[model samples]
Target: MTALQAATRETFWTIGPVGKAAFYWLAAVAVLAFGYGVYARFAAYARGREDPRDRLSNLPGRVVSATRTVLSNENQFDGDLYAGVMHTFVLWGFLVLLVATTILGIDIDVYRPLAGESFWVGDFYLVYQFAVDAFGLLFVVGVGMAMFRRYRERDGRLWGKHTSLEDDAFVWTLFLLGVGGFVLQAIGIVGQPARADEAVSFVGMAMAAGFEAAGLTTAGAEAIYGVVWWSHSLLAFAFIAWIPYAKPFHMISSFANVVARDETAGARLPNVPADLDHTNAESLDDFTWKELMDGDACTKCGRCTDACPADTVGRNLDPRDVILDLKAYRESVVDDPVAGRRDSGVATDGGVDGSATVSDGGTVPIVADEGGVIASESMESCMSCMACMDACPVDIEHLTSFTRMNRQLVDEGAVDSNLQDVFQDVMTKGNTFGESQSKRGDWADDLEFEVDDARETEVEYLWYVGDYPSFDDRNKKVARSLARLFEEADVEFGILFDDEKNDGNDVRRIGEEFLYLELAGHHVETFADCEFETIVCTDPHSYNTMRNEYPEVDFAEFADDPMMPFDREEPWNADGETDVLHWTQVVEELVDDGRLGLSGNELDYTVTYHDPCHLGRYNDEYEAPRELIRATGADLHEMPRSRSDSFCCGGGGGGLWAEHDEEVKPSEERLREALEDTDAGDGIEKFVVACPMCTTMFEDGRKTGGFEEDVEIVDVAELLIEAMEAGS
Candidate 1:
């Protein structure tokens, strides 16, 4: 056979035994560093307090789901398509190369020595070499994309407040390393006899021809090949070692975070333990293990910051910074103990038990308004909208730690005068508006039929008429319209009348923990007096807390008190069951079941619907209200950022009471989004809202922004009533 027909191969340890020995020594160090880095992260987690939520149940399923989520880049794509594409190429290409490297190691170390034959040969060799080059091409392209996007374009989305030289180093090194692999392959072929078989490795073969044309003799090629091989090997090992040290640290942390993520994270925020002393996270030490680890997983892609309504509107809150600051603080205490300070890690029974945490350092406050690692003002600026969590690619529980800091602010009495007033009103008057409890049912006074008190009647739907609907004059009209509409539908629903207090949804979000308990606990007590199958409310805030967070409260404590209106067998939330729902969900179900009849299309105005953060992002109830809108015979022109991606109205988490310096309020920003994003030719004449807070914010926005003539703010109930009247 001629030289052209010979097989193509690179023998193992071509530079001799000394070079091979040196490579092994370096590989050992890199592997050791990587192992220790991983260990330190997990060991440090033993400092945090245990989250009571069982994140490990159905462990296999979680692993599979997380694997799918990462592989598919499911959550990443929806927020920024360009970033998502970049991630996809990087992740898949990297995986392919990683597997190829592992196989090469086995072929050399295990098969050749023991079996006396290289397994990477013949048809298998051809296919394997071709696959490596094919996938390596993708890895090269992805790295180039990353480098150009980060350095050339200086894309603001990739550069958060924590942009560092590490990011630059990471991208440049990875790009060089990726391109270097192909170059090394070309060198391998040119340094040997020409081969027909190597043609299957198309990219490598093509490059080898170029190297031959460049006057590279066999001896010259061999010299260049040794240097290139060592360079690639050292760089590859270095990259692996750097995986847990630099920006690429997300590679490990992100996968672990995703695996441990709770599907109901923000919707059902973690319950504050009754016996815990670190109620206010004075430091990184006060956070739960998972909460503390959340920071280490941040990709800093800026999706959370970009999607943040507060950040978008120029409010002080930056979700990415919040995580990074906390992360930096955690890293600062690495020398204090294996566990930093708090003994909260859930690992027990030989897992990294946090109970064994050695307390060697004093406590430090983390959320000071003036100069803390995480400023209280940023926490206050949070709307509890969950937009950050929704947009996070790694499923970082930003709301969990964000709201915990808010609680600390509340503990320190650092809240602004406006929030302070609302807290006072809730404590003294049993509601935010400070209206008399006797006046709660006054909105239904002019209704065609007397609304049955849940206290005096058994009902299918115990409508929790919230503080705004029960007392605020504007929402009272909506309350009345809903009442009349329910009557028309012949729905079996009743209200608590003067008996109910605020459910403390916003109060809980604002960091008034005990006050929220007082309110939510009292409402649970009030519910014991009534017989109802389901709890429904027009206030999505009330609905959210009751459905998700209320399970944390043990209403059985009140069951023993003599002053309690009724006897109870178990704690109200002991079973973790409460069929809490928003009124739109109920009405939509009614409409589907043919219980609530709607009129034909008489109110066919081009319209847009505003999703309440509580109902849409937190509770996942986007479809019910939209279904109701379609039933109203209106031309439903949904805003571009509608459904799960809907913008907040800025009235939540005490934003209704507090103030900010943004150029436009979140509500006003949302109004502009609806007007500009809706595709109605005649212009959107109506903005329909499902939550009372949304109604208040958008209506105020419409008036304040001089868009009252452009679009009218109306509740879904009012639109239904309009269609109901037309049917009549």
Candidate 2:
């Protein structure tokens, strides 16, 4: 080799071993840091004592769906966006920095033998330097924005206390640590000048000129580099160890939780398990670990709390807090097995007293103490509206957990006396009214058509005349109108009549899962024996339970029962069941089929439609009812919160039976919105409803709000039936 080449080789050889040792040490530190992070994560999973299968099932799909949802612009919540942007940037920056650090460790330690000798080494070094500088800047900026948002945003301030001082300090400390590391590395690059033609680290090159101008000597620059690198390494290590104990732990835990989330649409209710016998199992004594883990998946987004009418009107409940309680309770169970053991009667090391005042119904009514994680009021105040489940981004079935707890209390006769009477009525007569089965067919009297058999005969459609439609005087008109519409269209339909049992949808929603299953089981059996092709019910609760909940029945032999099709894709109608019409749909179908006609001149008054929570949000059947109304050409007005965002009528989830302490009733609030829309220059004087529950709530609201004198409420089906008669 030439003299110059030999000298260059010697120069490289001299710097190589020192660089190799530095990288090796960095690699060792990184491996230890990563190892600690993994261990901590696994320890948390173990601590939570969750079912592994629950986490594993549908996880990949959930992750994919959440990613798509985040990226999409559809129906974005403004508050969520503000929070998401701050979180996403910080998360991405952290990821990039993490990767760069890992590579830096490997380059310094494992690949030091090849460094300075290979062309690839220079290229990789430049890339690593660029990545670190870019992500570090992003991290600093993102953290700054988050700090500002926490301290300055009006909404954030209004929501209560912002970020704690300790969290702010930790964030700023992290930012400074990252910045200092980069600055030191940049200074070191400036001290040791690379050839102009060589692959240069952009950040390193920029800093080199600054350092040269500042007149820092090579020895001084190296010393600064060593200090900064050491600080960065130590801080990184500390972050790994601190993750599990800090709020930042959500960074990892949230991702895991999101990935393992359920994949159903937010509006659909979860399936009620049919394993426990509602008739015999007196209390919540039958709950399994799977039932408990169902509660652990909550993300605590507060959407449920925001959506809850009870919370809005100053009720003591917060659905988000309820789910949090379940999580805390599950964690307590894990920490102290004795706390969950039925036979145990002493406090465990985990501080949970086994001898807490548990009701005969299996309800643990312990006061909020250091050892007890849940309170009685926390469980009782739930309205069972399924609002929490709807609002949950992860689709955690909060209502089911609440129902399980209620089942424990109700079965053991531990609930309030008023509720006990309702349960007894349900048990005795297969209906909440405690009326005889023979009385169920009373509404069918005076009708011009024959009531075909719902159970013993084959029919295109089996009209499941729900209890309210069958027994309630006001709702009977709705049933009669629906029957007339079907007859006009020549639709081959029959009624279950006295044979049809209560579907108990509200019972389940109100947390009477055991009673709900008993009712559901009988209904399922009745459907099977009747051999009905399609069961059409006006009640959304019945539709939801039959379609969604019954499938979870544990009996494998009954899994594919004709009543509950495994694949929900099959139509719930006869050969031409073009629509499983809400009575509104049937009326609309009759109009569309030319069997029924509406006279444009019959109804001169303007009308508005109140979208029921179930028909609108749960079933997505908003258009048919509105179309039926518009077919009459009545002036149609809409409330501000209509369609999927419609407020509940305050009668859902057995709210009709439970007398609420009238602070600001949900129905009154919804009615006020409707009243406001009526005066919106449309001159609407009537509010058209499709659900019986909505009708009941609005009528009550009308009386309470003193709007009965000026406005009127009518069923959507009744309007179409009226229009048909006008034309006839």
Candidate 3:
């Protein structure tokens, strides 16, 4: 054969024609199997209800965003550092190896066949050779770390009831592939007469030298290389086919999940039909296809569960279990409807235990004894803090799943007594605390400034004093502070006073979807009568709900009642549209514009700010509250878990009213964490909060945890007002 023909020969050196043929055949089978597995997964996903998750119009942008997230590894690093490093190495190694394989395939299949010579031959080939070997080593190292985590560390996050042998097999498969590839290359290079220079593949060269030192002959090395090469190739094929069947299905589903993520990052309660029937998720079929895919997309990283406040307090709810349980239920029912059904009085062992089949071949009950896929205790424990969703690297919306399940539980009247009372109070009295609507405006009665009722006067800003601020005695102080700030800024704002209703942010999260809609619709109706350019909410919950959810509620209700005042046709916050602003955000703007002046003594009181779930994660307004606090002339101290990682005060999702048996509450845990360095010279003496719920929870925590002597919990407005008073 000509020199060019020799150069263009198959890339493998020792593999005989039969071995190549066998490899090609196995590869083809793997591809076919992979295709079938993927098809089956999609078919399972198809069993779910329709979800408008795809943004086809902005497909290119979505792809770019997905690619950026994957390549940047931003989500992985946002939580645990050790896991992030391990994941980064594994991800980059796999990506590099995959790219190298593709290039090699192109060279062997197209370039060599057409041009009679491989394109990657000289220095570039050496670099390519080095790069592949280096990345293969990296892959092995990453796999080793993962193995350590699984075997030695045994992190509960990765290994638990949900984990199976498939998890181990997935990691082992990659490890074997990486180690086998390196060993095969080493033996091949050593066996070849023409391959003298070994440094180009440094890792392979070291292994080759070790083999040579062990007195292995060229023929023996060739035999070993032939066996190892095929072994590596076979494992690769097996892994490819196994991608869809096992826990690693996340490898395929994660991309789709990220690209198809909800447009808004905030927890969105799925809109239920106004009709009573089919209000919330009752079965697998009730969930949106995207929600079902969320089960498939989970990487089992445990970040969500770790960030969960309920889980932190040893509550029945585990965010990870919620997704996995739903996924398992969905998968079980995909092939056999009877597999996931709970027939009334049909006799069940209450779980996946016995031969209690209902004649349709199903051993597991869909809504096992633990209430449905999740126990009622677990469902009730959620604070709707969005911590779990924010911590998830794969973009799993645990809040959406929780809310959907909540809807079902509520519709079935399976809620706890406290929640039942809350529902009744909000529905009947228009507030969560069971206070009369007439008392909502009573907080404003003592303020020297005349607070205009929006119903009677036109105003630029309609100040929404949510439940706690309107009714709770402690929070009423915060309400008055904000009113004073508004007056000082000369902002033309009015309150809805007795006419206002609950914003229903927590109500929606609590699973009372219809009630939340009714409340939101009522507020929208109230806004129609009041001439206002903006709605400023003192409570973050109200701010989040008013800004993000109320518009949708208005639109949905407008269809039934055409006389609704807010123009349904206009875009949210468009021309002639009312803008929604959180109190801290507006106050920060005023301070920035030199309209609201405050004097500060940074040395007098060093403070730390606790981010409310609704304000920080739901609305992404971390900086504004801090900006306001800093503007108050106080030295800002930070807790370790602040901003996106902020721990919940345990009062969100109506958790404030709910009773807990735990010795240490999630709020108490946070209080202890906040008091970590109080003995230091610049220690935090006061805990600053922007959300009313946060203010209430932390204050109670200070008392319950015996932390009052060390740190005082105060609202951001109160602190600012104190500074303003001192300046005056």
Candidate 4:
């Protein structure tokens, strides 16, 4: 016979009857596995009441964003290289292996057909073998590194608390499963005596030699091959089944989560519906399924927790844990609908053996039971900084969810007595101070300009003077300065004066969703009668609420004016359309427009700016405020945590009113960072802040840190106005 014909015959012989049978069996198994996976996946979705299809239609855009995030080192730590490399390798290797597996399952000879007649199938086989082996090695190495980081490495700030034994065990099990699957495959390939020419399978050959030396005959070798193959298949199946119950569930959910990722960083909280009349909804209890599922999609990545001022300062509240608790509560409600029902008053065993009975009504305790799950303290720990919601990858409206639950507890007479008083104050006083509503416009009286009551007349801008800026004595300076900046800029702006109501951004963030909606609705109504082209505010919280949240009011046609004109519109270009601007931002624009001027002052003090959680992180207004500061010719010293990564002031989320343990005061920590940044021999004369809450915190922190006389806490608006006046 010819050499070519002989080679052809040998190739066919290698893939003889037994090989064909084995291939068909593998195909059947794959088909069944895929079918089962689809069923289980669908079932899980149905259980969660989540749609099986992509809710966000922008798949291509999402893919691009995800790719950018993975490639960028912006948010990730420098020490994550080893884990990052391993993760990337595993992801890419799995993708290639999946393609190869698909080809094998189809019974298509990829090496023979795709490579052409002259192409050596052996070479292709070697390539596949090497890839799998290399990937297997990487998978083992990566998993080991992750395990070490979780266990051996005592990095507290990055990893936070140590992982539980259960989590550690799961990680090791997954690692072993991967290693065994590859090792088994390698051994089975090498066990075939006729496959000796497949030189690329070096690992397999080594494994086969070990098996042979262990006294395995040809029949034994074949039996071992079948056993290993079955073991590998079962492990794969088990991994799939266990996915939903484990953190690895992110494998399936992360893709969808990324696709549905919010375009805006959620730094600005979304408004509750204002036009309640347009909807069939009657009360706050009538939340849609979408609203209900907001908390469930959290991956608990701790991005929010890391950014949270409260968490940074040692507050008991971890944003990630808060979302997890809400998710758990939601799951519990599903498991037993009667669990959350206050009317039932039926007590379950509290999931503990002879623990204290938790009644549906009356006061709920602040501390968790022995299991460390349910506690009012957990709810109170949140500062409503919106840092968690901003940093969340899954767009979990954690602040909103917590607020809703808090409201439910409070309404049902389940909250602490102190909290009840605070809520009552918020409800009656229009501010948490519990002062009369008539005091809302007291700050305006100190200003020289005529503060227009926009309630009766048409205005270019409706200034939302929030509770803090109006009532707080220190914050009153910010209010007065903003008014002066407006006058200097020649901008046609007016405040609601006494008519201004609470925007509810703070209250809602604090878990008082009901009060927030009500307050926001009233503000929306007050503005409905007024003709205004733009809504501007010094407070980022109020800005976020009026711009995003007030739209939830039920009245649709009452305020027919466009919220803000598009810059592209003719009228906007012609008349210079009014846009919402922070006081500092407006001052900066005026300086640029030559309406305002800065004085030449040798303000040689190096100043560090503290980003208000809402202003810098949420609203992306970091630059404007910084620019305003830089205009004063002060050396701008940036904190390690700045812009989107800025830490909270420990005064948000109603934390200003809530009591905190001395050990975990966020203000002290923030002040330390600011002080550290300005650690020159001369010392920082001024620590500039934009948000009123931040101003308050820094002032308190300065006093606490015993630097009250050394370092002065001042607002950016105050600085800008001062600079302009000095130049004048």
Candidate 5:
């Protein structure tokens, strides 16, 4: 009573010797089952190809970063605040409770049994007891939030066709694991031999006091406590065993996926180091082990689908379903990866022998028009905007998996007629519309000064005018305005003129792999002959490819060719990959440096900005355009879906090349949003866009959208130009 510094409990208190033995037996069985399920997943991974990106070069750093990310619950908070708060509480609460349980197990099994000393007592014991009690309540609250979000309030992000009976089971099990633990503790407290130290367990003490107040006599409490204790124990055991089989598999896969995820995944894509032509493979066997595991890692939370531009309107693609289907297929073929590892000729890089049939080992087709796990329609319907990737908490690279399937579709000539025509145009004329290569620089003809041809002269900037801005009349106007801005700023820039091609951005996304290679290779060769420091782009699509994807391409084979056009010793910027900057970025730089001189161009125009998916989400360059907008003295109002959640303009990933069948294309929906957001008491009826594709799609949206008559789509450069003139 005076100095009660030491406090602990028997591991199996009051449970008979036989009951203790039975508990150990159940624990052993649960551990074995959990171990087998986890091992089977790795066994499944062993069947896929090597992922070059899975380098362990910075193992310690990766572990530290992954640990910090997992512990902080940062990824979960990216877009949805409710989910973020809900998940943070659950994650931290569950982790604290888990750690407490582990310490108790270690104290009982290892520390006390082997060392004859306990680290499970005194201040540590009191603190541990308090933490478990507090976090147990927190865990229950989290489970309550999740259950309400899943069933009561029904969050759209937490529901879809992929949501199943197991989802309900996973949540209910977690609920019991938390709430039941507390109930068991309360009943145990009411009946157990009590001491002064027990008061530190505030929740249990309070519940025990309540039980006593309710006349829970020791005899009756003892009778009820045993059942509650055993039920809780069995539930925890089942929870452990079911982790790998149910939604809880995300606990393992999601963390690994996050740690291994490429920071620049959708933008740079995976650069498989083999003959990455994985077309002959029709099943999970074609996907790398990491990619196949991406399916398993998915939480089936439907967040990706919630963020999908394709799904936002009315498209056949559902990213959540795509991953779930892949996960189901992977479970079916878990044996195939294992068999392939045991001398079945599964290549190290996930490529298989062209002659070997994947189906021979139970792996089946993933994408097909008739019978497949992922419908061909879903794959094609994807805009490849990477909105799903940005939205995914687990870092599932949906685009990476979809890109592989799209390549297979291309191999089979499964592309639609509209896309096929564009591919042919890109192949023959080096532009999307089969436009003459000579006209690539026509947009600059009317500029105050001619943009120097990079082939003929050295320049500080090599502008990749891009296909749309160069070919499409509306965007060409934006191109000229940007060119005028560049000239006004005295920026030394040149372009390839006719030598410029489509840059193979959309071509790559459209699944014309070799064609993209061919087009990009042509530019690499031409750049070798030119002299420039940076490749400037007006199209975020082009900027994304050239800045991110192009350097990852293996041009050693192409560049080493004996007779490249305009023969050069090395590819452009051999000293380094040439810096790629979008015009808005460059314009911002110019304005910052006092190059684009202006004073009091304060046109108090309140305009909302449309963030292009590539610029905002893919590159995370949300502010560059916004800064330029403010530079023009416009008050920037953001749409509900701005920045990372920016609605797609329905012009990315070959969407511009194909017909949009939906009654309201994403571009149209986006326009409607812009109009609503900007209608604040006669706010300016113009919306600003930064990318060429955005301009193209939004211009069309302004033509056919519901508020077409009420709004105008202006490029960020055009608005800036308007401001400059206003100052003049």
Candidate 6:
């Protein structure tokens, strides 16, 4: 076939010469405008304080992760199927259209000039036309669904009084741009002379037929085509230019945020560099650049807020609002960090000024409640349960800013009376309750076999009985039960007696990093004198902090770090360097090996397991407790929100000590969930918990929940011990 005939075989843009040139001009202006917005957003981020997160050390791995996140959208889909599908279609549709546009640009500017004919023709061109047209229609459908959810149906998750005008504009821009493109295509199909052959796009053909059925003539179609084509082109270019200025800026920022996400576990908070008594983030300049960038990446999806226990239980803490307000505050401030340093009469050495205190002097409130970034009351309301971080698709660390701000609050001596008491107790007595250190091992007094003191004798497992299990009366029973199980399994475990103190898990979460460091350092000193192979704890909080967070602490200088039978390179295995096991894991291991002998007992109660936040989300240890429950011969029933999605018992992050409004406490809310009909529509009789905090919170919740002796909360170890004794 001739080159001209081949180019003409499959139809192309019928917008004529003048209109085509005008469209190109609009696209050029759109490109420049989009660039300007991007540059401005990045420049604002650059003004944020220094954070060492800029290294980009693992470039290849980060790129792979970013690409996977962009392509999958799995995080969003995993949470809400409807939202996920809609977002995926819109994202992939936009990506496909972008590719098509690039090809078209090449065909028109390079291929046509070089070969005297466009590259897209025949069967290939037909497939290209069909795919682009189909994806465009899909994009419109997705946008329409989103528009309905945003405006008409008003899904509570998407719409709120706090929803911004920029958000509305973002959705409307894409919705209109999509609708206009489809209408323009329909008009083009009808106005073309080869309408019969060019009606390859079924969607465009159907739309054109509808237009024709309404008494549309060829002349009318042609005139309408020109106007619709121009409108669609203008809308496309304008939407592109408006992207960085709208909520849609997340398209760019979310990708960067994912690439820049901290690779540590979700619960690991960065160590504060400055002296705790001296400084913390008191302004936008005090926040790390990456933290400031997180504000730009937020899509205002409300997933984090919806999952937040504090928010769910009627606390003033909303993760989405906290991040959004921070971004807004940053934007409201000057772009240049030192722009008016001398002019405003603020010392360049960083000290307090009127209304705006410099970060160095620690006088300014970091993430000030008065400035509306995050309210001080809201900060207290947080449980540090990690639900917000788990729910966030864009990887916004809501706790980072809150924790830093909280550190400042602590440094300024502006804590609540209850927290003050708890902090003082931890400092003075090495526990939150201010109990005597000598009584730490009193819980195991009833056990038939003796638990060796690690300081006096070598043992296999050094049991780190956390604050609750060691001091609280109810949790002390759990500790005794666990000790009996260890005796039954013939495990050589010992405690530090009066020497063991709090492991500083909750202390660290409460934003007292230096105090935690001191406590942890003391433990390192104690461990150096003891000869033990593994460390086991009854509390998930201690297990998580010791296993994950403690390694970051340098203990090499502390008496050459007492030699271990295991290697550090292979962590937590039977012969691994430093093994730290939760008691549930130890019990499960004992059961699995036929050592505890649970095969003889039959636990008849219909029970459900409550996953502690530290165990399930922080350390990903959900199955061990359940497995141990099954070994007890109990008919295990699962809660609707079990495992990683488990509801907090309201005791993590110092919530055990912090006073909360009784009417809206997270523990009561979770207890109500436990009392509700199970997923199988059967009521659970007993609530089995793994962590000490879970046990304490639920025990209190049982008293407050007003249940008629229908449900009882017990520790998993307690249940196991009961089974073991019954079997014996």
Model 1 weakest lDDT span, ten residues long:
348-357
lDDT by residue (686-711, candidate 5, tens digit) is 78888888888887877776566677
- Residue 287 of model 4, lDDT score: 36
Q: Write the per-residue lDDT of candidate 3 for residues 1-728, one digit (tens) a residue.
A: 63322332236767778877888898889989989999999787776777634434587898899989987788887866777777888988998999999999898889979999777866667778878988878888988998888888666778667877888888888888888888887787778756656466888889888989998778998777766777778789988888888877787899888888885745445566545345356556677778888999998878899888888888877888878877765665566655544333243333332112333454333332352456667777889998988999989888877787777778778777898999999878989889888888999889897899889999988899888999999999999999999899999989988888888888888888777766766677677778888889999888888788765543543445444333443324423267888988888988888776664453368778888888888888899988888887788878888898999999887798798666589878887887784343237788888888888888888888888788888888888788888877
- The TM-score-based order of candidates, best leading, equals 1, 3, 5, 6, 4, 2
TM-score of structure candidate 4: 0.77
Query: TM-score for each prediction?
Result: 0.93, 0.76, 0.93, 0.77, 0.93, 0.91
* Residue-wise C-alpha lDDT for candidate 2, range 258-344, written one tens digit per residue: 555544332334444433333211212333333343444443346677777777766656666655555454444444444444455
Error of 3 at 518 (Å): 1.1
Pairs of residues at least 3 apart in sequence or in different chains that clash in candidate 5: 49-349, 49-350, 50-348, 50-349
Instruction: In angstroms, give how far residue 277 of model 1 lies from its true place.
Output: 3.2
lDDT of 4 at 225: 63
Q: Which stretches of candidate 3 lie over 4 Å from their true place?
A: 1-10, 52-57, 275-279, 337-371, 554-576, 677-682
Give the range of the ten consecutive residues with the poorest summed lDDT in model 3.
Answer: 348-357
**Model-by-model lDDT, in order?**
0.80, 0.60, 0.78, 0.60, 0.78, 0.76
Q: Residue 327 deviation, candidate 4, in Å?
A: 4.9
TM-score of predicted structure 2: 0.76
Query: What lDDT tens digits, residue by residue, belong to model 6 across residues 64-116?
Result: 98889878988888669988888888988788888988887888889889999
* Total backbone clashes of candidate 5, pairs 3 or more residues apart or in separate chains: 4
Task: Please list all clashing residue pairs in model 3, or write none if there are none.
Answer: none
Q: Which should have the higher lDDT, number 3 or number 6?
A: 3
Candidate 6 worst ten-residue window by lDDT? 564-573
Question: Count of backbone clashes for each model?
Answer: 4, 6, 0, 19, 4, 2
